[model samples]
Target: MKILVCISKVPDTTAKIAFKDNNTSYDTNGVQFIINPYDEWYALVRALEIKESQGGSVTVINVGGAENDPTIRKALAIGADDAVRVNTLASDALNTAQNIADYAKKEGFDMVFCGKETIDYNGSQVGGMIAALMDMPYISYASKMNIVESKATIERDIQGGKEVLEVEVPFVLSAAKGMAEARIPNMRGIMAARTKPLNVIEPSNTDYMTEIVGYELPPAKGECRFVDAENPEELIELLRNEAKII
Candidate 1:
């Protein structure tokens, strides 16, 4: 099983977020970056688990600039055999997915894994886009996957229950929680990662279907409203009319 796992670099969850240039760009100053947790904890770790059990190599791929190299290296330390960095700064989902598909197309990987969404953007767009561009089957929010020979059994959470599926090789899946437990790099693994191969390549396409207009922060918290507990009708009305939950 030759597996390809997509990696993403994102700000630490505890980092302070701010916008710059009149709220058009994200501020990087004083920000700490890390491997997107969904990618690291679930997708990448699951891929490594497969490799350990099935006897094949795992390759980690990312589409970003030099700053992302360290993030990719962390994946290597976790247990990937090699890494590929598409040396491009693509904030657009279409372009980023396109870049990954362009490389995976040439690599002939049997399985492609991705986190359900990045922590920063939470777009949940790239995995599906890559599957579409590659003309491959896509399974989103997969929480469990088992491989035997050339067949794969997968499970995903749906509205009320879990959905199970069977697929062959050469498919894409977005990993969710419960895929695998997170693994921290040991000292030996960390030392080996320094010498592991990390190939950098340029993107095949640079054009993007969309671009960011600008970013605006959400509105500040509104004042609290009190509803008379004596009247359930009033509480229902407040929830429906004000909170809009129903």
Candidate 2:
């Protein structure tokens, strides 16, 4: 079983987000980048778990320029056997997924794992796109997966309940919470990561279908108002008038 885990570099959760070029682009002046939490905590960890149990290799892939090397290295430190960095800017989800699909198709990986979405974009589209490009089955929001022989059994979230599925090998899955526990890199893993193979490849000729015209932050939150618990009528009046819920 050769598993490919798609990882992404995103701004740290605590980093202050800002825009540049008159709010047309993100400002990365002093931002700290890390592997996207969904990718690291669920997707990558689950891929590692599968490899460990199945006696195979887990390869991590990222789509970005040299600036994302540190984030890819961190995934390697987390226990991937190797890494691949697409030497291009991940302008949009479609382009990134196409590039990954191009590489994976050539390598003929048995399984591909990706997070449900990237924290920055939250476009939950890459895994399905890859599956389409590779002409394979796609399972989204997978919380658990078990492989026996050449068949895979997957569990995923659905409205009001969970759905279980079975598919053959060579499929794409978008991992969500409950997939696996997060793993922190120890000193030995970090040292080994420094010597791991990180292959850089040029992206395919796929262009983005859409582009960001501009960005604006959400409006600032309004001040809070407190209503006495004893004054139920006043609370109802406030809800009907100021809050406009009634």
Model 2 TM-score relative to the real fold:
0.95
Q: Pull out the clashing pairs in model 1.
A: none
Deviating ranges (above 4 Å) for candidate 1: 222-246
Best by lDDT: 2
Least accurate 10 contiguous residues by lDDT in model 1: 223-232
Q: Please, what are the lDDT tens digits per residue for candidate 2 over residues 1-246?
A: 999999999999999989999999999999999999999999999888888887889999999999999899999999999999999988788899999999999998999999999999989999999999999999999999889978999999888999999999989999999999999999999999999999999998469888899999999998888888888789889999988999
The alpha-carbon deviation from the true structure for residue 63 of candidate 1, after best TM-score superposition, in angstroms, is: 0.6
TM-score of 1: 0.90
Query: RMSD for each model, in Å, please?
Result: 2.7, 1.4
Candidate 2, run of 10 with poorest lDDT? 203-212
